[model samples]
Target: MKVENLYSKSEENPMKALVFDKSGIENLKLKEIENPTLGPHDVLIRVEKSGVNPIDYFVVNYIPVKPMPHIPGAEIAGTVEKVGDHVKGINKGDKVIVYNRIFDGSCDLCLSGREMLCRNGGIMSVITNGGWSEYFAIPDKNVFKIPENMDWDLAASLPVAALTSYHAIKELEVSPNDIVVIFGASGNTGMFAVQLAKKFGAIVIAVSKKNWLKEFGADYVVGYNEVVEKVKEITEGKMANVVINSLGSSVWDKSLEVLGYNGKLALFGTLTGADVKINLSSIYSKHAKIIGTTGGSRRDLIELINLCRDCRVKVWKTYKLEEGAEALRQIMSENRDGRVMLQL
Candidate 1:
């Protein structure tokens, strides 16, 4: 296959992208915009596939307008078409996954190998234009090489959902005997969390609406009705050693309620609204730890890619770029079982 170098800008060039004119609106119109100019340390990518995440809609509809007509998307897989002057180790035509978090290497967090938590961290699609386009440019350090044999759609799905799961599972320090509870286990991120927890040797107890449990490979699946009791029963009144909550407030109390003493509750997302009331006694009494996680580092992304490359992990599905919005809609409506991708 002859890889196209779309990022090589001439005097006249244009790129197609989905853009939102304002917040609180669901409409995203396709527009022909100027190709992005690459910086000295940047690598330009011709996106082959972009993964749709829940945050894409949240920021489009909820976030305050930073600029008019924002393009919202984060995860993407593509071929590097151009490399800036200072870029090294990556060449044009390399298959790659773009990490959304951009940080200065000189920052304290970055210096300590915590680039995801750097004070100057910038998230693609949120702070800047993202991968909902034909081509995009990002720092070379943010692009992890994807194995040539790996499916582009799967590669696209890795940047956000999988990375976040990797980060959360790492934080939990899950062991083979630990009982891990995954809230919203059917969603893309949640499903990845479930699989990752299981991979780490934890016995997974996936929690979701009654109808979605079987699909998630949950040992004990429960619905909204008697959720806490069901979980308690599943654990024989012992509860989980680690609770991974990607749905946030919707399952906050239940997550906290189902943790064993000294259990860790890793909160990654707020898919179902953010606000929730929690009892302080429950946390303190059980010595439960509530840890908040965001994105992952370059090293984490590399590890995840290697895992997927080695067949240790599998992606659910792959879609073409034209199907981007539809993929997003299915994910947002909870109609999809696994990660949805947009192929270029």
Candidate 2:
């Protein structure tokens, strides 16, 4: 889809919104804020649900581009309150999910179906006030209609975790019969990675507590301490075909250790740390390749909804929008397994 234009008009009425007028988590405030008016090419959504993420915490303290009194929420699902005059396919009162990554479709990367790599793209709720409010406006193209019967909170969680995992796994092109080892396989993205890899017909070995990830699609689960040794045993010395490392430097060396010849290592996050010392000799010796990934395209979001509808995506628990901060904390907690959601 193409993003033709994006411009918001100021509305006369104010709506409830969470604002951070200053830096710090304690500075987050919920109050009445001006509602964004609908642009001809935009769709105004009345926020129904949103999910929290660690990046939301980082963006609140960092990302200087967002002005004060900014709203922070990357995973948003809502109803179309109003459709811009020029908007199509979308209508008022439709249940929809927001494609949070805003990109200029005319850019080379965007036109090539690599919108995630588009230099002009800006993450919603970071570059501007987002779904923490009862009302928000975005380009018509950014709005996707979810099945009417779908749970808003579940759809809300899909935009970020589901999209990111889908992108990373697809980037590595995990194939059937491939020996796939996924690190951090219990976190939001990790769990999705486990399921998606299995869906692609790979034999998935998850790196997490054995009991925590057993309910999902993981063929086997092992604690990080024994991750490498266990993979070797499972593969009978062949090692893994692809290693997905979302935890970053913490497991970089180990991830490289379990890779078989021509193995692919997909790096998607820097949760533990960013910097890592590379072993050229190791990579060259194994003929391994490294691929970096991030957010997925809007098309992936659409596909994710279908997957969720088909029960391919799992929903573990949900919290109200009033408990959003706690929901963010839940994702970081050791006890929080699978996807955590927020109902508005």
Candidate 3:
């Protein structure tokens, strides 16, 4: 069946979207397509901004998108254009952010508060058409109103980087006495990890080439090569009680070396590489705990939005919808300091 036929309240008007028929940036194109189909519990959003992330880059150049031609945005913020008959409390023109993870709600994982890992769920751009369009539609439950004081750029940037960082920090149970070290401190998730760790009162040591991490609340900022010695000196040989490594295998050894006995390490992304070689004694001798986290749960999302009401996040740059491809390209390019977004 045609994509338009899936919607019961179909509109004849066409909308512009940035899409790719297959996995490759060279295949990305901007064209007119039917607006997304809205079910009884759906809400139509006129996208105001779409934040670009490494996953969107992965979706465009590597991963398989279910629908042949797919829109590649997972972090979205916008206004309600329409609300289905069954949708309540959400009205036209309300500012909102997409939850990005689609869950069945009745699955075991969903019931246990792990909707991001639901038995029958998937991330936005990969499983369905996403928000790199003029208009997008999703289940009303997956959209939440942005706090009235939040700006378009901050709201759009939170769904992925901020939420993922928040979940990882929460999982590690950071506390005031814990000495925390965050690798990739200047990247998308890394930036938020710094702030959230500080908020929890952990003494944050940020690992990055940049010295500006202190502005985001890193108690100490050091280069990649300086992590071991610096962390040792800072802790007076106590080592870090928690290490947040989103960069993966390239820094795996150091991430482990910096951990104190009985410390916990959180793992999320693998921007460097996945495969790593580690001695069993290295883990056993230290009494280390390794946590693998992905996206945040619905509750985590709610908590983050509330906590970040007065918090600051960085938005590196903004591009027009026509500049979507360039916006994605910059995400993997050098000298990137903050989130890149597409203003619709």
Candidate number with greatest lDDT: 3
Model 2 residue 257 lDDT score: 96
Best by TM-score: 3
TM-score of each model, paired residue for residue? 0.88, 0.92, 0.96
Q: Where does candidate 3 stray beyond 4 Å? A: 1-11
lDDT ranking, best first: 3, 2, 1
Model 1 deviation from native, Cα RMSD in Å: 4.2
**Model 3, 143-223: lDDT tens per residue?**
898887799877887899899999999999998868999999988899889999999989999999877789889999998
Where is model 1 poorest over a 10-residue stretch in terms of lDDT? 1-10
lDDT of 2 by residue, 1-344 (tens): 23222223455676777777877767766677666766678888888877677777777666663656677888888998888789989998999989888788899988888777778777777766567777778888788998998876567767887788888877888889999999988776887788888888999999987465666788899888998889989999999999999888999999999999999999889878999999799999999999998888977877877876743445567776556666666666767656676666
Instruction: Summing lDDT over every window of 10 consecutive residues in candidate 2, give the lowest-scoring window.
Output: 1-10
Model 1 lDDT per residue over 231-274, tens place: 68877899889988888787787888789999999998887779
Residue pairs in candidate 3 whose N, alpha carbon or C atoms collide under 3 angstroms: none
> What ranges in model 1 sit over 4 Å off?
1-11, 24-27, 65-67, 209-220, 224-226, 310-326
